[model samples]
Target: MPDYDLNRLGSRAFEQMVVALGRPELGPGVQVFGDGPDGGREATYDGTINWSAAAVGVPGGSEVWVGHTVLQSKFQIKPKPQPQDNAVWLQGEISKEIGHWIKAAKAGRPRGTEA
Candidate 1:
């Protein structure tokens, strides 16, 4: 298993989620802390767009967290239509990520054994 830092992993995962969303306008706002000689304690990637199609984060960990918030054209309590055509883009993104995950899993399997 690959050991990854929580904040770094979260940021990367958030960025990947945005790319996976396929909406150029929906890219996340990423910020990093601790760039100086002394390393800082935290970092974050704030995503402005809501990912109704997918969620990111580990399955079972207290430190693991996932959140999504959709922005409406107006501040209304009722649901509203998203301006971008997200259906097709979301499908393609899911397919691509699933394929990559499958490939990685296969590659990680023991040599000469069924994947």
Candidate 2:
């Protein structure tokens, strides 16, 4: 086995990789949308996902995630030295996307549903 340079993979490739790697956990029915406008999501699953609380960094046994699940991929290879050097910016971007989802839900139109 050999290790490859993951940094060379652009955001699209990284998103694809994330989908592939998550299949086992997210089930085989996970839908992946490559390219074009993502609408704040790269992939989605509308079913049960069996996982352990430890997998989610919590202390517990098994856990189940049911209903609609959205997956987003964010990878930055710019600024050289450390792409994650701007952790605050990355977190802010994620928070904004989450806020959009929450707002839509509050308005009775959850994401992935027709308005």
Quick one: best TM-score, which candidate?
A: 2
TM-scores, all candidates, are 0.25, 0.75
- What residue pairs are clashing in model 1? none
Would you list the C-alpha lDDT of every candidate in the order shown? 0.40, 0.77
lDDT of 1 by residue, 1-115 (tens): 9986433445445444444444344454533333232111123344554444344463432232244322211112222256354555556655664565466567785211333
Show where candidate 1 strays beyond 4 Å: 1-84, 109-115
lDDT of 1 at 108: 82
Give the total clashing residue pairs for model 2.
0
State the lDDT of candidate 2 residue by residue for 1-115, as single tens digits. Answer: 9999776898778888988887777878888887876677888899988777346665576787889888887776673465466686688878988888888788888664534
Candidate 2: misplaced stretches above 4 Å?
1-4, 53-60, 79-84, 112-115
